[model samples]
Structures are given as structure tokens and as C-alpha cells.
Target: MAEQVKLFGVWGSPFVRRVEIALKMKGVEYEFIEEDLTNKSPLLLKYNPVHKKIPVLLHNGKPICESVVIIEYIDETWKGTPILPADPYDRAMARFWAKFIDEKCLPALWKACWSKDEEQEKAMEEACELLKTLEAQLKGNKFFGGDNIGLVDIVANFIGFWVEVLLEATGSTDLLTDEKFPMLCKWKHAYVNCPVIKENLPPKEKLLAFFRARQQPTSGPKYE
Candidate 1:
């Protein structure tokens, strides 16, 4: 019997988006259960007992938690288009950059937009430095893994799509200007315009509103 596949995820989460992109790329058919992180469903809790997070993949009644792990599992299970490179060293490099994006790049970018006044300035500086390091990694190709979208490309959606929306909603256009980070800017344009990625992305207007509400004074605590 074919294993039943299912995913639990929210609309605006980049982590969830990465899993969706991987599934789409591999042509995997799965049921999507939209999660409200504030009031998380019992199924989500039951599957991902450790993190209690979305983006959990259930295959044949067994659960796999975490976005990156899910992506790898989908790639290994489906066996269509490969997201990770076959060469060992290149594969290691991909994992390295993907980890860097998750660990170094994203936190800095969040602090850049979420912090206030002097802290925001400091965060922007830190983000700029971190982003430039990523830009350096993109010196030769249209993506982190050359022409094709891959693991690093999927995980770095924050820099490609979310950061622009964040800057607009936060009224910080100067944060990611073309001149300051030309390579990254060009890469962002390519990443956002890529047909598969563009199709899967949440609408810009909706994303703008979501971020705007979160930034407001009395918008309440963030769940995701």
C-alpha cells in the first residue's frame, strides 16, 4: 500500500513554505492541514511532541518533525528531482550554507526589523554583514546551488521574499537596497520570480498586512 502523506503548516511561515516547496518539486501528493499556531491542533501536538510546531510530515501514520528534516525525508522518499547535490563535498557545502542561513542570517534579519531605535540600527549592521557573507557565496550562480533551486535556496526564502515585505511594513526601505547588496538583490529578484517559487509564495499584500499587524503596539504576542 502507498503511504499516506500529510503536512501541518501555517500560511506565512517560511519554515512551512520550505517543506511545501520541496514536496511540490518532488511531485509528492500530501494533505495540507493549516495550523493556527496560537491554538495548535491536537494532531499537531500529537505528531510533533517535542517542538509542538507546524511543518510536521506524517507518512503512513508515522510523524517527522522539523522543516529541514522533512525536506530531506521528502527528497529521499520521493526520488524525483534532487534538492541536495550528489557530490559529497558540494553536499556538505549546501548543508553548511543552509545551516548558516538558519542560524546566522535569519536571527540577524529578524532583529534588524523587530528591534527598536538604537538596537534596530545595531541589528541592521549585523544583518548587513551576515547578508554580505551570503552574497559572497552567490558570486557565480543564479542561486545558492547554481541554476536550480535547492535546499539552501528553499531555506533562504526570508532573504529572497520576506525581508522585502518586512522592510516595507516596517518602513525601512533602506535596509535592503540594490546598491548596498547588489548580488543579493539580483538573487532575490531571481528567486522571487522563479516560476515554482513565485507560484508557491503567499501574496505580497497579505504578507504585508500580516507583518504590519505584528509590528503594531497592541498586536499581542507572536505564536510562530
Candidate 2:
């Protein structure tokens, strides 16, 4: 009998999408179990006791937590489509940018989302610098790993989706404007339009609505 593969995730999470993309890339068949973060299940808690996060991949009852770690596991376990380069130097380069985005860019982007006006402006500036660095990095390559989609591409592409959504939700358009960061803008077009990515993306209208709702302040009954 074959080992059972299962994934616990939430639809709106980019981290969950990372695992989804990797599984799709590998042509791995797995059962996707959606979890409500507001009401997490015992299984999710058991699988990821430390972080208590979504996107736990269970293969033959062994759990793998964390999005990037899960992607690396998916790449190693499957032999059909290669997500990482076999060459040592290229693999190192891939890991370098993946680490860079996870460490530097993602946090800045999140800060920009939940910050106040002035703080948001500063966060946006930092995000632009990060995007500029990536724009320059991609000057001669189709993907971050060069010529083909790979690990860095999967991780880096998360920002592309959220950046646009953040720009729309926050009413700012400076991140990937043509005049400012042309390469990053072009990369967004290419990355999102790729067949695998395009098919797997969450709907834009729904995402915008979700963000908008999140931005609204909760109200209580007024007592005179």
C-alpha cells in the first residue's frame, strides 16, 4: 500500500500556497485539509506544537511543518520535477536568495500591511529597496535560479501576489511601478502568468474583499 499524504492549510495563506505549489510541481497526490485558524484542530496542534501554524504536511503519518522546509522535503522526496538545482554552486545561490526573501523581504512586507500612515510609508520604502535589489538580481535571468522556475522562484513569487494586493488595499502604487522597478514589474507579469502559478492563485476579488474586511474596525453597541 502507498503512503498517505495529507496537507493542513488555510486558503488565504501564502505559506500554505507555497506547499501547494511544491506539491503541484512534483505531481504528488495528497489530500488537502483546510483549517480555520480561528478554531484550530487538535491534529494541527499535534503536528505543529511549536508554531501552531497551518500548512503541515503529513506523509505516511510523519509530519513536516514550515513552508520552506516542506518544499525542500517535497523536492527531495519526489523525483519527477526538480525544484532545486543538483549543482552545488547553483543550489547555494538558490538557497541564498530564498533565505534573503524569507528573512528580509517578507517581514518588511508584513510590517507595511499592519502599520500606521508614517510607519507604513517607511515600511514601503524598505520594501522598495528589497524589490530593487531583486530587480537588479533578475536583470539577466528568467527566474531567480535562472532560465527555469525553482525554489527561489516559489518563495519570491509570494511577494508578487501580496505586493499588488497590499498596494490596492493600502492605496499605494510605488512598489512595482514601471518607472521605479521595471524588472520587478516584468517579473511579476511572467511569474503570475506561468501556467502552474496562474492556475493555483486565489481569486483577486475575494482576496481584496478579505483584506478590506480585515481593515475594517470592529464595532460594539453604543450605550447612551
Per TM-score, the best of the predicted structures is: 1
For candidate 1, report its TM-score.
Answer: 0.94
Off-target runs (Cα >4 Å) in candidate 2 are: 216-224
Global lDDT of each candidate: 0.84, 0.80
Q: Ten residues in a row with the worst lDDT in model 1?
A: 215-224
* Predicted structure 1: lDDT: 0.84
What TM-score do all the candidates reach, one by one? 0.94, 0.91
Clash pairs, candidate 2, are none
User: How many collisions per candidate?
Assistant: 0, 0
For model 2, residues 1-224, the per-residue Cα lDDT tens digits are 99799999977778788888899988888999989877889999999999888789999999999888999999999988789999988888888888999888877776666566787789789987887787777867777767777898899866768667865875654566889877777777888898888877888888778777675322310100
- Candidate 2 is scored at a TM of 0.91
Model 1, range 1-224, lDDT digits (tens) per residue? 87799989988888888998998899888899999887899999999888898789999999999888888888888888899998999989988999999889887887787778887789899999998889999877898889888999998998888888888888863777888988888888898888889888988999899988873433212423
lDDT for 19 (candidate 1): 90
